[model samples]
Target: MRSLPLATAALTAAAVFVPSLPAYAAPAVQITKVYYDSPGKDLRSNTSLNGEYVTIYNATTRAIDLEGWTVKDKTGYTYTIEGVILGAKKKLTIRSGQGSDGTSTVYWGRRAYVWNNDEDVAYVRNARGKLIDSCGYDSTRYDYKNC
Candidate 1:
């Protein structure tokens, strides 16, 4: 009988042990809230739409750069987050319509309403196109899903 080579024997042993070890997944930074429909006398106006927003929370210990990230509605409206750093355990809110960006809130700069008052979905994706989170809502019957 021929003896197994040193590299072959070591690789076989390593493979057997490695497969049993659990792989670690990265901690999830989640979408904590979505104020998709802003209540007011007027829903079509920019001011009313501006009140519509989505909030993301960083549940990790380190600061995260959200630049190039996108928050988009089921419709064509998409808000690109730029030059924003979410601190550890911090929350960032992205609102619809035009406004100056601030520490806790940012604007999407759309003149019209992005979220449908009756039903809509919001999606968040990182720079690498990885889906960070998503939420859906149906305001007519007050049904909110995947929040």
Candidate 2:
């Protein structure tokens, strides 16, 4: 009983002197995967080009409204995304060719290949042109083979 008040006061003083941790922001949308190389007999065909895609992921547990996002390749090919709601922990794949929008996939409607077989970089930006995420590739090296 004699030491209860002294212990409480000491703990309170230590807590007051200790610094609090900084607050961290939620994770933004990111390019989790990139399928730059299309595997088929005809690389230029609509079917083959449509197979090349990039996948964006929302890792958080809240819906994100991607109203005016843009995905651009290293060769200046830009795909503008319209009104789309990305659900929590969900992924959206944007193909290089034409197709109707689905629950987890969308189309870029490109006639030619947007990504190169040797090397390339894919960038994802928000409506304000701020980079959300990006992925790169290098086919020439043995260790860097994401092309």
Best by lDDT: 2
Model 2 over residues 40-137: C-alpha lDDT tens digits? 76558888998789989898899898889999989879999887899999999999988899879999998888878778889999999998878898
lDDT of model 2 at residue 111? 88
TM-score of each: 0.75, 0.77
Tell me the spans in candidate 1 whose CA falls farther than 4 Å from its real position: 1-27, 141-146
Q: How accurate is candidate 1 locally (lDDT)?
A: 0.80
lDDT of 2: 0.84
Q: Identify the candidate with maximal TM-score.
A: 2
Predicted structure 2, TM vs. truth: 0.77
- For model 1, how many clashes? 0
Worst 10 residues of 2 by lDDT: 138-147
Model 1 C-alpha lDDT per residue in residues 113-136, reported as the tens digit of each score:
777778888888998879887778
lDDT of each: 0.80, 0.84
Candidate 1 Cα RMSD after full superposition onto the native fold (Å): 7.0
